[model samples]
Each structure stands twice: as C-alpha cells, then as structure tokens.
Target chain A: MKHTLSVLVQNKPGVLARTAGLFSRRGYNIESLTVGVTENENVSRMTIVVTGDDTVVEQVTKQLNKLIEVIKVSDLTKESYVDRELVLIKVTADGSNRGEIMQLVDVFRARIVDVAAKSLIVEVTGDEEKIVALIAMLKQFGIKEIVRTGTLALGRGPKVIQSGKD
Target chain B: MNLTGAKALIKSLEYEHVDTIFGIPGGVVIPIYDELYQQDAITHYLVRHEQAAAHAADGYARATGKVGVCMATSGPGATNLVTGIATAYMDSVPMIAITGQVTTDLIGNDAFQEANITGITQPVTKHNYLLHDASEIPQTIKEAFHIASTGRPGPVLIDIPKDVQTMTAPFDYPKKVHLPGYQPTYEGHPGQIKRAAKAISEAHRPVIYVGGGVKISGASEEVRALAETILAPVTMTLMGMGTMPADHPLSLGMLGMHGTRYANYAVTESDLIIAIGARFDDRVTGKIASFAPNAKIIHIDIDPAEIGKNVRVDIPIVGDVKRVLQKLMPMLKQTRTKEWMEKVHTWKREYPLEFEVTGLRPQYVVREISRLCPDAVVCTEVGQHQMWAAQYFSHRHPRNFISSGGLGTMGYGFPASIGAKIGRPDETVFDLAGDGSFTMNCQELATAVAYDVQVKVAIFNNGYLGMVRQWQELFYDRRYSQTKLSEINFVKLADAFGAHGIRVDSASEVAPAIKEALAVPKPVIIDFRIEPEECVWPMVPAGAALNEIIDAKSGKV
Candidate 1:
C-alpha cells in the first residue's frame, strides 16, 4: 500500500538526506516526497508518499521520531484533519478543443495558468479526490505534463496547533 | 540556531575531548562543512568516499576516545555511507554520519535526487536526526554526538535538507545540553562500591575479568591499580585486552574458547570474580551455570541493562569503570596474596603461549608485528587471527587494543583499525585479519588511501574461514559446511585501490613486510599464507567450562 505522511522536523543541514537515506537503505519505495516551511519557522513539514507494508510505515514513523531532528510524524492517511494537494496539469487545448476544455475547467474551478499553441496549464487545488477527478476529465484532452505538491495537512479545530511539537 | 547545532556537536565532542573530523563536500552539507572549514579550532579532514568518510570518522572516534563526524550529499551520496555506518554500529564505535537533503518542496514530489536516509540508517544507528527547521540544528547535533558516544557507543545519522541549510538561524554553540531522558551513570553507587570492595578484600582467591569497556572508558590504569591493591589475578575478555598490561604479574591472558590456560585456571578456582566493563558473553562464559562456579561475581558497568544480561550478578555496581574503581580503591584493604599469585604463575608457566614453529604459524605473524610495534594499537576482525592477536600481542596501555568483542562482527577490524588510528595518530594502527575476515570489508582500504591515514593490515591468509573450520574439525567431524573459502590476492586488491600492498610467504619476511608497510605512512596490506589446519590453541571445546580448554588436539591439558 502507498501511504503519505506529514513529518515536522527541526530544519537544518543533513536532515533531508538522512530521511531519504533511511527509506532507500530499508528498500522502501518512496513514491513521492515534499518538504516546506510550516506556520512556525523552526519547524519544516514534509509530505512523504511511500509504498510499503502497513506495518512498515508505522515502523518508519517510530524510527523517524527517534531522530533528534524530527519533532513529530503523522500518518495523514489515518489522521482526521484538513489536507489539500495542489496540482498543475498541462492539457491538449488548441482551437479545436478549447471550448470543451474551458467548459470542463469552469466546472472544476481550475484556472488556466499558461497557454501554448496546443497546450494549456490548468491549476487545481483540492484533496486527492478532486485532483484525481480533474485529471480523469482531462485525460481525453491528453495530459502533456502534471505536477503536484503531494499533500500538506493541518489538524481540524485547532488552537494554533503545533502538529508534533506536543 | 547555527550556534546551537554546531555548539551542541562541539560541546558533546568536548566532553569526549575529540579534536578531529573527517568528511567531504556537497550542496546540502555546505553549511556544516563551511562552519567546520572556517573553524581552525577543530581539525577536519577531507576523504574520498562518503563511506570512507564515515569509516575514517569512526576510526578517529574509536582511537581518540571522541565522537567522529562525517558528512555527505543527499540520495546516493548519503546512501553510500550506510555500509560504513553499519560498520561502526556493529563494532560499537562512536560516530556521527551527516548527509544533505533536497530542499523542502523537492522532498516528496519525485523532484530531482533525494532519499530518506534517516529511515535507512535507523536500525544501525544509536540515534538519528531529520531536522526540518534550521534553528534546531545545534541542539540536534549535540544530541546526536551525545547518543553516539555514550553507553554502548555507536553511529548516529543526521540529515540536513538544503533549504534549511540556507536559512538564517542564530548559531549559538551550546556549552551544555539538556537531554531529559539521557542521563549516563559515570560513578558507581557508594553502597555497591563498598560491598564490592568488601567482597574482594574478604575472598580467599579473587579474579578480575576485564572487557572492552575498560579500554573504551580509559579505565585500564584504574583497573590495574584496583587489581594490584586487592592482589587478584586478572583475566581479560578479548575486548578487554589493553585494559591492563597483558604481561603484568597478575595478568592471566584472555579467557574464552581459546583463552590462555592461566586465565581459565584463575576463573575456575577464584572465590570472588570482579567483572569490570566486561559483559559475560557466551563465548567467555561457556556454560553459565558452571562458569566461575566457586565464585561470587561482582559486576561493574556503566549500562544498567548489562549488569545482569547474561550471568546473575551477586553485586551490581552501576557506574563508569574508572569512577567505580576510584571509589572502590579507598574502600578496599590492600593485600599481597602470595599463594594465589604462585598458583596463577604456575598455570602460566605450564600452558604458555607456546606453539610449534615447524609449520606456518599465525602466532608468528602476530608476534613479528607486535615486535615491530610495541605500542601499536591492534584491532582485529573476528576469526582465528582475532584470537591470535588477543593472545600474542603484549598490550601495555589502555584503549590500545580495539576489536569487535561483544558482537564479534567480522568486517570490524579494517574500519575499527581506521577508527583507532584516527583516535591515536601518534601510535601505529595494525588490523590483524584472517583471510576470510579481511575480505569481508577490505573495501575500506580506499578510506585509508583517501585520507592518507596510515594503517597496517596483516592478513593471516588461511584457505578457509579458520574459526568455523576449527569448530567443524573438532566438533562437527570435519564437515566443513561451506567454511572453505576462495583465494583472494591481497596485494592485487589493495593495489587496485591505490594502497601499498605485499604478499609474504615466509616467516623471515614478516618483520620486513610490516616494517616497510609502516614506513610508507599510508594504508598497506600484507598477506601471509599459513597452513589451513593452524588453530588458536588452548581451545575450550563447545559447551565445556572455562578451565576445560582442550589446549590442543593432543590433550596438553
């Protein structure tokens, strides 16, 4: 199974390499990973997508927490919180198919970021469900390129919660 | 805070008095490497392989009684350091492995090159770091070094992402660190120390069983002082070599399957056994129920978990070996037991380190190396030569003999010797290896060549995995069972990696090979072929008591 995890850590040199090194050495297939600053400057949050046994992900979480740099790790797939992913999709949309693509884009509320001779880049933001639906609708137009921010999550009904700092 | 991370690392090392680091360059690690480069305060060496870098760092840590640091890039570069990290972890050498990571956004998008290195190294490392923010670097680094160098010291992995590296953070190197759950006991409790001293002072015959912790914690002098004060015989674990002079009057050599006769005799007859820094591994205490049968065992160690791990402890002194000895010294009454000393002397005279010189001898190779390097720090890979070095080398100082004693890891000698050399650069470092054991990690020769760290490797080139072969020959009715090994040309292999290499087939050439190898001031490998049947003598048959050593096939016992 593939699982996406959000981890908060003390941003510093060597932290990324050590985290990545762990997955590879253990032969865990890392499907995707994204790390960026959180609301707080001291903590940088990572969105990691990995394919492994259910048990392996939990083991990885425990091990990740053991690192001095890692403040906390949450298996977002199992957590009840607000999470969103932003994906930019470049689809086939020239004069011949422009009208049909625009109607579909309007329904999804996705914006056209860039327009080329035969392709239009559509920016869509939602959870995995909305993004997957948008990608499926654009499949007929052909997907020239696709880029995603993976998933960043925040626990619901928070009081300015520090995800793993507690 | 940059100061916090850097200072934490430096402060933890200062506790160990570490003076050096070995690493290389990369994008993510620039922040750290830059800090180190600008600091003339701590010496940093640039080595070739990230793997070599880590091993060299481990060598420095083990040799110097300090924590060693090595750095590398993200993805493959960081992954390359895994083998060396595992090496240090297996051998219990304190090392901190640092690697760079991709910027935050590139982390999970399959963007560019990035790997989850901390997860990869978790099993092998004592602790690790995956710093998400730039500010926590110092505190994490300090924690890494602290966890690595304390208790059963092992490797710690720290991964720093690129963005965090570039982020501006207040760099305040800490002079002290506050780790809530990480208190290490350095002094044995006063009550336990007094009880132990009373036992030693009251015993009719006493024995001190010393192990690697003695050498690691620099308690040899204190151990010897305590032993002499109590007038007890000393038997060293393989790791305990150099805990006290092997040739000391009270020293009874090594104790185990192939331990010296005097060491086993003292173990068998003693009324009180003082085990300091030594874990009672199965190899040392063959049949636990029968080991030191007549003795009341007093166990002293820094790790509370190890106090009663194997053998039951009559008195457990939970503290550092040196501090425990210091406290116990004043509490004990000094004595000169002439009769017990006389018996141990007799055992030494009878079953000496005597082997027939007619055939190719592993002991001869070790003896020659020891002859040239009276003060050399000897490390060994696990096998026949490991036992030989433990027996043949006359270790006079503490922390001079580094080997994988507890775990008995095979590829230990090569890298551990590198660590020992880095620890004590003034003293020559020699890795005494069996052919089978040497081949396990001979790739580390590149580490030596990269840093120009001089380490001499004397390969006891037996055609088989000598230790396993001996067990099969003696107990399994010569069912080799894949113990037979392939031929490896040591000179060619070492030369392939840009190291000085030689093959010595004659006994007379032993001294010359070691002397020439030592003179080059670079890593050198010397291979010595010996008869396959050659065994480390005073062999205790499997499942037998300590004193029940076979001595040899013909029954010298």
Candidate 2:
C-alpha cells in the first residue's frame, strides 16, 4: 500500500539529510519525496510517499516524528487529500510527428513548453496517475528525456499540519 | 558577558551543573581544552582513547541519571566516538558528546584533521548539531543537554568548528529550550491506561516484563509496585537488571536469548504480558511470532515507535513508564493467579540455573564478586563474561548493573566502571571483563590510576573468545577459527599502570583475591583463569523460539 505523509520540519541545515537518512537506515521504502518552504519561512513542509502496510507506515510516521527537527507528521493517505507531480517529457518530434504530438498534448491538457528542431518538451502537472499515463503515451513518440518533481500533497480541506506555535 | 565559543561552551556546561567530563585532547579541540583549563567547575578526565571517553561518560550517565559528557577532536578522534555514541543510543542512555571540527571554510575541503562528524554520526545520534557561528554555542549546548536527557533519552552530539570556538560571542545560556518537535509524552492516554488496567486485572497468568526504560525513567519502584499490585511475576531483560531486586519473590532473573529457563517459560506460557519500558528485541523475543504465544501484550514505553516495532502489542501506552504506571496502578484489581504461580514455581524449581562445580568457572567468579560486593555497581564487557555476570550477579537498584545491552560493545566495562565510580564514589564499582574484551581499552587503567578512581576489574581469562568458541562448539562443528586470544599477563599490565593486580587460577583463591583487591585504594585487575570451553547455559539458539530453550543438561526444556 502507498501512504503519503505531510511532514513539517525546521528549515535548518542537515534536516533533510537527517529525515532522509532515517528512511534509508531503517530500510523503509520511500516512493517519492518533495520538500519546499511552508507558509512560515522557518519551517519546511515535505510530502513523503512511502510504501508499507498500515503498521509499517505507522512506524514510519512515528520514527519521522522522533527526529528533533521534525515538527509534525500527518499521514494524508486515509484523508481526502490532493496530490500533484509535475513532469517534463522531451519527445523526439520532427515535422512528421510534431502535429500528432501536439494533438496528443492538447487532449491531455499539457503544454509544449520547449520546441527544438528535433524535439518538443511537454510540461504537465497532475496527480501521479495522470503524469504516469502521459509519460506512457509520450514514450511511444520516442521520449528523449523525462523529469519529475516527485509528489506534492495537501489536505483537501483547511486542516493544517503546521508547528503548533504558528 | 562576551566570551569565546570555547569559554561559552564551558560556561553553559557549568549552567547545566556538569561536574565532570571524560575527554581526550586533539588538534581541533586544543582551543576547547585551553578553555577547559581555565574552568574550575567541571573536572575533565583525560582518557587514553576517545572511545573510552564516550563510554565512561555513558557509564556516568547510567549511574547518576545525569547527562554524561565527552569530547573529542575531529577526524579520527570524532570517528572513534562513533561506537560509544551508538552504544549509548542503542541503550537509550542520556549523553552529550562534543566534538571539535575543522574550521567552517575547510569543513567540506578535507582540511587537516577534518571530518564531517555530524554527517558521520547522523544515524547513531538522537540529534546532532554542526555549529558554524560562535553565538549558537549557548543555545546549542542547552538544547543538546535538553534533547539528550529528555524522553527516550539518547546520545546527542554538537560539532563546533575550531574557528567558531575561537570566535567571540555574548554568552547567555538559555533558561528553557523551545523545541516544539521534541516534547515527550510523559503521561499515557487516560483511555489507554484504563484499558491496560482492565486487561491487567483480568489476566490470571500475567508476567511483567521490564527493560532498560524502567531504569532510564527512574521507575523501578513503580514497576515493583505494579508487579505487586497485579500479583504478576516480573522478568527483566538484560538492561532491566538492577531495576527490580533479584531476590524479590516476583522477580524472574534476566529474560531472552541467554535468559533464565523459567523466565522464558513464564513468558511463553503467559496469558498477559505487561511489558514496561521494554522493546521486543530479537534477543528478547527468540522467534517473534512464537514469542509469548499465549499472551496479550501491553507495551508501555516513552518512544511510540517501539510500541509495535516487533511484537504485536494488544494495548499500547505511549508515555514515560513511571508516569504511566502511576496512572494505571489505581485502576488495577488484583487477580487470583495461584495456579499460574504454582506452574511458574514448578518451572523455576525444575530448570534452576546451574553449572558444574568441578572447575574454576567464570560463573563462580561472578557469584563470589556478587556475594562479596552485593551493593557494588557492576559493569561488564561483552562476550561470555557479560552473560555470566548478568546471570550470576543479583542487582537490587536502578543503574547498579550497567552493560551495553543493545550494541553489546566490547571494552565497555572497564572505563565505564571508572565513570560509574566517579559518579557514585561511595559505592564499589566492578567491571566483569573477558580477556578479549578487556584489552580493547585496558589503556584506561592509566586514567583510573591517575584519578584514583578505584574500580575493580575481574578479567575472566579463558584464553579464548569463550562466547564465540561456545557457539562454534555447539553449532559449527567445533572449528575454533580465530576465537583463540593471545595471552597477556594482566597482573603485570596492571602493575605497569601503577594499579594493583592479582591472578587467581583456582576457585578457592577467588574470594581472597577480591578482598585484597577491594583493600587497594586504586584501580585493580584480578585475572581469573577459568575453564576455556565453558558456555552460558539456558540458551535459546539463534532464531529458535522461546519454548525450545536448551538447558544446562543440553536437553530441550
């Protein structure tokens, strides 16, 4: 099972290493992780996607909470949450298939951010499933390169996982 | 007042009421050592090895319930402290390890005597800091102490660059720390406590399993009270030794891999396991699935992650053991467990801990030491001597028996005993060591002698790594492979260090040598040449279930 966790931590040196090192050291499976500054400049929010059962995920959340720099951990897997991952796929598109690629991009509501003589870079932002589906579709067009922003997640409602002091 | 980071560091330690430190001076730490020289409040014991310094600090922490402090310079000095730090972290000992790093500019350049200590120690330390500025000293030191000594206490490291230490800053130690992420839940949930209490009252064959957490939390009395209230037998894990009086009627010696047969049987047959301050370690739970097969477990620990890490916890109470026990004690109703008690008693009587009385056995040496110095603080180096000490010595108070439970580091006992003695000068301190384990840090005899820290070390000189040898004999077709240790005349070694020394080859000479060693006012090492092939009995083979324990007669009980 996949569980997405929202972790708020102090935006200090080695906090990321400390958090990431924990998962590696404990042999916990990390599917994806994205970190960015939160509403407060001093705090950073990390959306970590981990693969584990309920018990293992619970242990992961508890262990993450144990880190001194970590402010809070909210498992958003069960909650109604919105998650997105931005991906860029540079496809080998020449005059022959450029129109077809643009048509496919339009149907998927993606943008052709960069165009070169032999390639077109399509940028798309959506949930993981949508991006994965778009990538699979672009693979047939001979994808030159693909990059993903992992996953960024938030609760669907106004429920916040921030430092209580804030 | 304006002061350099080094001075401020010393000042912050004084504010924390740190009376002693175990450390070794090095290139990067010279500035810190210079400041230490100007200090009168903290007495620093210059240890021979950086590792010993950390272990000694850990020993002091275990004995005094105060945060133990140690220091080392960067690179090799800092790397040496890794094992000691991991040892403390594993056992949940409160410790603060200060390391002097290369200057900030050279941190990533691999300058002279440089190491990224914070990065190296991240996996081992509970928390660590790499300070680049002088002004962060006071707050960092305060937070280091606070984090190290708080809930689920463990080792915390603060790495100060040499230039940072030389930089000047205003010194103002923070009165209180503001760590929003580090608040430990000291009180159990009311609903969970009620559920646990109800389960305890309903259990007819309940066994109270205790571990190092009880000692760390200072909950020995609470554990005993709970055991008495519930009329449950108390079985201690290796680290839980000294948390409950061994002679108490409810006490079932140490449990787990090398645990007593009765303790294993009791846990196996238990209807309810009231585990306080204990993690279900693999050593404690032979085969996890089969461990306490008949029981519903109530795991009470300060660390929530430990609740169901291994065992399936029926009732999980995340709180300090002392506070949780206090809340749950009143809600408990005593159950009638006469039949269960009789069965446990029968197992105890049938599978008593015994060894052949023919030769000078290591167990006999430990027993004599325990008999003579019943009130002494006992520490042990890893291997056969450690298990024998755990089995033979009777501990009656928290921190009385300090050994590396989780990491099982060799060479832990001697320096640790010195630290233990320094912490509690009134009590006798003994290090039950094996020849293989003792020589790892025997250089600390100089530190012990110089400081007049009178700690007795009983070296079970078996001329082989007895524990590994025993394992080979039983499981590996008796191929000894590298287990044979080269002999060293420990008496001569002790004499060279200006400490007293004695060698006893016979069981009859053990008692007299201990008495003579006790009379000496300095460090003493009594090397006892024992049966080379002796093994710690009541063994549960690796990966074997608790019920399949092999007894003294080599029969499955």
Candidate 3:
C-alpha cells in the first residue's frame, strides 16, 4: 500500500537528517520525500510518499512522532488531500514532429518552457496520475532527459494540520 | 552581570538541581572545566574514559530518577560517548550529554579535534543542538534538560564550540520552556481506562506484564494495587524487575527468553494481558506470532509510539503508567480468579528456578550476593551473569535492579555502579559482571577510586563469554570459537588502580569475601571462579515460541 504522510517539524539543523535516518534505519522504502519551509519560519513541512503495509505505515508514523523535532504527523492518504508532482521533460523533437509535440503538450495542459535545436523542454504540473499519463504520451517522442520534484501534498478544505502551539 | 557561556551553562544546570556530573575534560572543553572549578554547587567526577562518564551518568539517572549529566571534549572524546548515549537511549534513561566542539571558525575546516558531534549523535539522541551563539547557552541547556527528563526519557546532546564557551552573554534561565511540539500526555483517556478496567474485571485468567516503565513512572505501587485487586499473576521483563517483589504470591519472575518456566507458562495461558510501561521487545516476545496468542492485551505507556509498535492491543491507553494505573485501579472491580491462581501456582511448583549446588556457580555467587546486600542497588553487564542476576536475585524495591536491558551493552555494569553510588552515596551499589564483560571497560576502576565512589564489582570468572558459549553449546555443536578468555589476575588489576580486590574459588569463601569487600570504603572487585560450562536454564531458543521452552535438566520442551 502506498501512504502519503505530511510531517510538520521544527526548522532546526539536522532535523531533516534525523527524520530521514529513521526511515533508513527501519528499512522502510521512501518513494518520494519533499521538505520545504512552512509559513512559520521556525517550522518546516515534509511530504513523504512511502510504500508499505498497514503495520509498516503505523510504525513509521509512530516513530516519526517520537522525534522531538517532529510536531505533527498526519496520514494524508486517509483524508481528502491534494497532491502535486512537478516534472520537467526534455523530449527529442525535429522540424517534422515539432508541431505535433506542441499540440500534444497543449492537450496535456503543459507548456514548452525551453526550446533547443533538437529537443523541447516541457514543464508539467499535476497529480501523480495525470503526470504519469503525460509522461507515457511523451515517452513515444523519445525523452532526452527527465527530472521530477517528488509529490507535495496538503489536506483539502477546512481540515488544517496546525503547527502552532495548541 | 555579563557571564561567559560556560557560566551560563553552569547556572542552567544549577537551576535543574543537578548536584553531580561525570566527564573527562580535554582541550576543547577546558574553558567549561575551568568554570566548573570555580563552582561548588555541582561536583564533577573525573572519569578515566569518556565512555565511562556517559555510563555513570546513565546509572545515576536510572537509580535516582534524575537526568544524568556527562561532558566530554571534541573529536575522540565526543565520539567515545556514543555507546553510552545509545545505551541510555535504548533503555529510555534520562541523560544530558554536553560535548565541546572545535572553535566556530574551525568547525568544518577539518582542524584538529573537530567533529560534528550533533550530526554524529542525531539518531541516537532524543534531541540535540549545536550552539552558534553564546546567548543561547542557558535556554538550550534548559530545553535539553526538560526534553531529556520528560515523557519517555532519553539522552539529549548539546555541542558547543570553544569560542562560544569563551564568549560573554547575560545568564537568564527561563522559568518554563515553551516547547509547543513536546507536550507529553500524562492522563489516559477516560473511556480507554474504563474499557481496560472492565476487561481486567471480566478476565478469568489475567496477567500483569510490566516493564522498565514501572520504575521510570514510579508506578510499582499502582501495579501492585491493580494486580491484587484483579488477582492477576504479574510477570515482568528483565528491566521490570523490582516492580513487584519476587516473594509475592502473584509475582512471576522475569519473562520471555531465559525467563522462569512458571512466568512464561503464566503468560502463555493468560486470557488477559495488562502490559504497562513496557515495549514488547523481541527478547521478551520469543517469536511474536505465538506471544500471548489467546490474550486480549491492554497496553499502558507514556510514549504513544510504544503502545502498538511491537504488539497489537485491544485497548490502548497512552499516558503515564502511574497516572493511568491510579485511575484504572480505582475503577477495576475485584475478580475471583482462585482457579486461575491455583493453576499458576501448580505450574510454579512444577518448574521452579533452580541450579545444581555441587560446584562454584555464577548463579550461586549472585544468590549469595543477594543475601548479603538485598537492599543494595544492583547493576549487571550483559551475558550469563546478567541473566543469572535477573533470575536468581530478588529485587524488593523499585530502581533496585539496573542493567542494560534494551541494548544489553557489555561493560555497562561497572560504570553504571559508579553512577548509582554517586547518586545515592549512603546506599551500597554492586555490579555483577562476567569475566568477558568486565574487561571491556575495567579502566573505570581508576575513576571509582579517584572519586571514592565505593561500587562493589563481582566478576563471574568462567574464563569465557558464557552467554555466547551457552549459545554455541546448544546450537552450534560447541565450536567455542572466540568465546574463551585468556587468564588475567583481576586482583592485581584492581590493586594497580588503588582499589581492593579478592579472589574466591570456593562457595564457602563467597560470603566472607562479600563482607570484607562491603566493609572496605573503596571500590572492590571480587573474582569468583565458577564452572565455565554452566548455562542459564529454561532456555527458549531464538525465534522459538514462548510455549516451546526447553528444560535444561530434563531436556524436555
């Protein structure tokens, strides 16, 4: 089972390493992890996508909560959440296929961020499913290179994972 | 008055009511040591090795329920404290470790005596900090102590560079730290407590499974109350010894691998298991799939993470054990488990913990020591002697038996005894060590004599690492391998360190030697020559089920 966890932690040196160390030590496979500064300068939020069974996910969440730097851990998979993955794909394109590639990019709601002699850098942003579909369509065009920012997530609607003092 | 960072650190420790610290000073931490010299409020015990310093602090913390403090220099000194810090962390002992870093400018420059102690100890510590500004010393120290001593206790580290120690800052200790992320839940949920109490009252065969948390939370009395009220047999983990008096009718000696036959039997047959202050460690759960197969479990612990980490529970209460027990005890209705109690007693009678009394045995030595110093705080290094102490020795009070339960660190006993003695100077402290384990950090004998910390040590000199030897004999067709030890004159080694030493080869000599060692107002080491082939009985092989325990004498499973 794939589980997405939104972890809020104190923005201090080594906190990220400590949190990551827990996963490696427990041998839990982390599919994707993205850490960034939060609204509060002293706090940071991490979006981690982990693949494990129920027991493994429970242990991971509990262990994360044990870290003193960690403020809150919520299984975003259990709730209605919005997840986004950003990908920059460089696809091989020549004069013959350039127009068709642009048309496909438009169909996928992506944009040509950069243009080169034989390739077009297409920037795509969407949920994992949509991004995967776009990548499948672009792979037919011979992908020159691909880079992705791992999934980042937030709960939908009025459900807020508060970080401030309760 | 403008004070240096060292002075601010000292003031913060003073505010925490810390009276003693253990450490070995070096170049990077000289400024802090100098400040320590000018103060009389806290006494510093100069340990021979930085490792011993950390172990001693751990021992003190476990014995006295106070946050143990240890200090060390940069690089090697800081690295040496890793094992001890990890030991404390594994056992949930409250400890504060302060290390000196190279000057701020030379931190990442690969200068002499420069190591990133905070980064090195990140996984091992509950929390850690590296101070860049002198003004943060007092607050950081305050936070470190609070974090180390609160909730599920663990070691916390603070690494300060030499420049920060010399820099001047006003000392202002915070009245109360405002850590929004670190509040520990102390009270159990009312519904959960009610459900747990109802289960206990309704259980036909109930068992109270306790652990080190009982001692940490000061819940021994509450555990007793709950057990007596519900007529449940109490089985404790190795670290949970002394939570229930060994002689009590309801008490079953330590459970799991190498646990007493009756205790393991009771756990196997119980219909309801009330686990308190204990994480179901692998050592205590021989083959988790078969552990308490028929029982409905109720787990109570201060740390929420420990509740269902290892075992599933029907009712889980996340709160301090003592507090939760107090509430649950009052709500629990008395149960009539006469038939269940009688069945447990029959098992106890059928399989009592015993060993042959023909030759000099480590079990005999531990028994004799227990007879002589029952009230003394006892600690043990890992191996056969540690299990023997846990099995044979009767602990009557909480915090009376201390050992490296989680990590099972070998060389833990000697230094831990030093810390235990310093924490309670009026009480007697003993470390039961194996010959193999005693050699790991015997240099700490020098630290004991230097500080006049009178900690008695009894080494079971079987001439081999007996635990490993036992495993080899049982499973590996007796290969022996690296388990054998070369002979050493332990008496001379003790004498060289300005401490007393004795050698006993016969059973009759054991009592007299213990008496003599007790009378001596210095650290004493007694080497008892025992049979090398003697193994701990009622063995449950690793990965085997709890019910499949093998009897040593009859070879029956």
Among residues 3 or more apart in sequence or in different chains, the pairs in candidate 3 whose N, CA or C atoms overlap within 3 Å are: none
* Chain A TM-scores of all predicted models: 0.87, 0.97, 0.97
Candidate 3 stretches greater than 4 Å from native: B554-557
Please name the candidate that would achieve the greatest TM-score relative to the true structure: 2
TM-score of 3: 0.98
Which 10 consecutive positions of candidate 1 chain B have the poorest summed lDDT? B1-10
Q: Which pairs clash in model 2?
A: none
Between the candidate structures 2 and 3, which one is better when assessed by TM-score? Answer: 2
Off by over 4 Å in 2: B555-557
Candidate 2 per-residue C-alpha lDDT over B74-144 given as tens digits, one digit per residue, 9 for 90 to 100: 99999999999999999999999999999888879879988888999999999999998999999998899
Off by over 4 Å in 1: A1-166, B1-19, B23-51, B74-92, B102-117, B150-152, B494-498, B520-522, B541-543, B554-557
Model 1: share of real contacts kept = 0.06
Candidate-wise lDDT, in order: 0.78, 0.92, 0.91
Deviation (Å) of B497 in candidate 1: 4.1
| lDDT for each residue of candidate 2 in A30-77, tens digit (9 for 90 to 100) | 999999998899899999999989999999999998999999999998
